[model samples]
Target: MAGGVSNEEVGGKLWIMWSQGVLVSVVQSTNQFITVNMTVNNRCVCISFVYAKCLQMDRRELWNSLSSGIVDSQPWIVVGDFNVIRNDQERRGGRPRPFSAMEAFNKFIDTAGLSELRFEGNQFSWCNNQQGSARRWARLDRTLTSVECITMFPEAYMQYLPRTTSDHAPILIKLEAESVSYGYPAFKFHQTWVTHDSFLDCVANAWEDGIADHGMARLARKLKKLKQILQIWNREVFGNTGQNIQHLEDRLSRLEIKLQEGNNDEDEQDYLVAKSELDLWQDREEIRLQQQAKQTWLKK
Candidate 1:
């Protein structure tokens, strides 16, 4: 972690963590946010994690700090729970969000040259969790990146994972590069397949289809049948994971361009749907890579 809590009175703090291979150096830190330069594979990028104060007056300090401090040309990314929304559409079941608040937030993005990254999963990342009439939902958490950052990793996107114990859902920012293709080998079970909603159903169906034998031979036959079924399922459900991600990235880029020119509700909805689908596949990709690394480590 690169930052710490400065004030005991404040309810929230900011921190940034990375794996062993990545080099991280703190550039600046405050109660509101932590700025750092991260180097991976000899490429450096600046990232800031923010947890803004609930009050608009207090948040102005964070806005000013980001707008004035991050003046460099490096690929820059800003993410976290901002505690503010950019527009009316971002909130539901609450009193209409104040226009002044939205205006100020927009002003900061414009000043900083940051674009809200297209995202997948739930539309709202936070909720009051109240019942029907009293409930409130808002997109308080988000990922924003500079034009340079987008150019550097055009397939990058943000994913709002389903909320569990917390009122706020966890968000993931994926910075994807072009993938290298390796020829397919023997059948191997991917750990990520278990996370899919339909995986169990597919497994059960494949297992119960009725093999003729009654001993070790029967089990062997069933296993072979299941493998074949799983391979087909993987292709139909996920396709080529890397290629699918690239395709979605292209679609999102076109939608974003159309959105910037003007507001189109249809385009906005399509972008959200595509983002959600991309995130699902990206999550699977992350799990598969982690498992592969563990296997390689064990072999060595």
Candidate 2:
């Protein structure tokens, strides 16, 4: 909860709630941000409640302030309304966001060694309920934490709660008692992976690389070998599906901007190319979401 919830909680004098084994205390507070320090089971977790400004510079300043407060070797979690998105896919139907604007936020996350705590539920945490050109949905609210936090409470995960009256969704960060072991994520093929130019080549190479007796056993071995190849291909070529979409969107935005500045034929051509690629990725995103939701109505 970023906008209304923060206001209501602060107004109702219920900003901080403490309980046994968990001690919550305010470390810093400003109109745009609040830092809460909590100690549970002798492990200290720093949570920053942020409400960043709309302007790029203001958001960058907020990031700067946040990065400054992080202590080395301590568990930290930052949550709440960031107001700015790190990528184009985070928002839909609004004016494309510039790469430079997100640079500061990305840099801060990198420098602070923070990772996004991928949550379950809606992809977007906020929405402007307008149709056509005015419609916009964005993942403005996010939960991010230090690597140490993930290492300590491996089972901990964040969830984006449904939005009620407020434009923002309340994020629930759950920390389980047992520590989870780190392991490789299961191999699952994404439709988006096929959009790349080298996709067919990569798959063919993986298929041809396998050698075994001709039967079901050989098929199983080939599939197992293919999974490993795809995993490596994903890291080197695809990266994160959502992030790849964002990067393509960012490139499209730049080309569009350049075209708008003057009648540059090359810029226009590049814009079209990027736009086409973005469309393909977006379609894959829709398919991925439908598969995840497992709605009968959405099934092909």
> In model 2, which runs have C-alpha deviations exceeding 4 angstroms?
1-21, 131-133, 177-300
Instruction: Tell me the number of clashing residue pairs for each predicted model.
Output: 0, 0
Give Cα-based local distance difference scores for all models.
0.81, 0.73
Against the true structure, candidate 1 reaches a TM-score of 0.60
Which has the greatest lDDT? Answer: 1
lDDT of 1 by residue, 6-78 (tens): 3224444664667667788878777888888888899899988888998989888889988877757889999
Clashing pairs in 1: none
Give model 2 RMSD, 1 decimal: 13.7
lDDT of 2 by residue, 132-231 (tens): 3454677888988899889888988887754434667678889775568898766777766766899999889989884957899889899888888888
